[model samples]
Target: MIRVAIDAMGGDLGPRIAFQATQKILAAFADVEVRFYFDPQHFTVPEGASSNRFTSVSCSEHVASTESVDRALFKRCDATIFRALTDLAGEQVDVVVTFGNTAAMVALTRYIVGLLRPKLYPALIREMRPAPLKCLVDLGANVHCPADMLTGFALLGSAYLEARSDDAANVALLNVGVETSKGSSVIKDCYQMLSARSWPAFSGFAEGFELFDGGKNVIVCDGMVGNAVLKASEGLFAFLLSQLSQHSMDTTAVEKLVRAENRHGACLVGVKGNLVKGHGRSDEKAMVGAIEYGIDIARTNLSKKIEQKLIQQGVL
Candidate 1:
């Protein structure tokens, strides 16, 4: 059975969404076991959580979203997040899903369970455009990455897709324009480096317009630009929806594509185990999606696949 450790004390609503989602997940997935770490004073165990598959561990303390990463690791060492990570490190859990402070989660995962292949953390973001679905790496993990760092992100992203696809995924570097002369020297050098690789079917440079066009399955960019693009797209979508709301249009389709709850979570690529960071303000539906996403990662053995590919490429 797949075991998942959840930080029930994380996120804006603390343990409420986590508990609600846990109830749904437990009902839907019979083979999965869940360990919830929460502050006992704040959270009450639900009747549905009494099953053998569910385990609740009450934590004395919790970490706030605004807490500094260093403080969260040291001062709040006994926080629910740390308790969940400790369980994961001890091999008591197969995966961890949390809607906690992103920076703290990243820091703790690197310091505790360890990084497997690419030492740098890459934010794994998915594009749901039905025409052509794709994955984007380094959405907001590393703001200022060098050429080598971008190369590492590419490897991590390709390895992730490799876990799901029998055929090689077409990888591309995101640029302002399709021309190699359009980007900075770092991007140009990264282009040269990726073009020299044999595996991953490295396609040439891709533009912003091509992101939703479904032309490339994997797009690599520094966290700064990628995050900006992601937020911009979200904001643009919201603005358009607000403007068009007066027209009484069926907006569910468009909202589903760019909503925070729809994306739900981002995987911390390069980690040794499955670790998904759910949105801090996620509702029950989003948390459920995050947990299921972690389950998908565990079932696919994404970490092991990435490690093997990295070893084969002499990258580990």
Candidate 2:
């Protein structure tokens, strides 16, 4: 049985979408199970969610307010999210999925499971995109990072790429150009280190415009830069939508379902648990997609894959 530990309190849709998604998932997969860590009777399943596959656990407390790394580990003991995960222990579930505060998950998971000892601040991000298909790291967990952390991001990104695409060695560091010396000194140094290293198959620096090229799998950068890039991409898309805002565009109710799968978020990779942080302004479709993504991730045992790669490359 594959168990998905969900932070029922997280995300904009809260329990409604979660309940629906849980129902949809259970209906779709027999082995999939959803354990909602929400306030007891906080909400009800939409219509047909009371199946044998879905169960709800009441969490008296909630995740910390801030996105600090400390909050993830220091969450209130009574918090539903933490309680559900605590019960998960080692074998009950596969991954923990959350659309809540990003930093809180990181902090709490690290505190509970400890960092990847060798790669202390391993890059925990999501790359399941629609158009660009970019594996972006540090969407907002850590504002500041060093070279090794960035390199670790590359490794994590490579692991994701190897699992998702045919282009495994196509991983690149986010840069202004494909040159060895590009961007800030820190970035340039990381570029050189990765370009020289044999691990993760670094493909060299990736320019800003080349991010959406679809050939590159991994794009490593600091959270500040990554966040800026994400905003810029969203702004560009919105601008394009405005420019191409058609009066008779494909805005059918069916389109809403497709848009949901285009979720923007990343999963926490380094920690033992399976936690994904959805974009702050996620909709019902995105929320459902996130839940589905959690299911796929849990079934794939992605964390174990990364561990194997890290061990093979001596990163562990």
Best by lDDT: 1
- For 209-248, candidate 1 gives per-residue lDDT tens digits of 7777755878899877877787787678778999778788
lDDT of each: 0.79, 0.68
- Model 2: residues >4 Å from true position, as ranges? 41-50, 64-75, 128-133, 246-264
* 198: Cα error in model 2, Å: 1.2
RMSD of 1: 2.7
C-alpha positional error of residue 272 in candidate 2 after TM-score superposition, expressed in Å: 2.4
Task: Give the per-residue lDDT digits (tens) of candidate 2, residues 72-163.
Answer: 35647777666756754565678777777766666667666556554557555766354445677867777788887887777777766665
In order, what is each prediction's RMSD in angstroms? 2.7, 3.4
- State which candidate has the highest TM-score: 1
Task: Please report how far candidate 1 places residue 58 from its true position, in Å.
Answer: 1.4
The 10-residue segment with the lowest total lDDT in model 2? 64-73
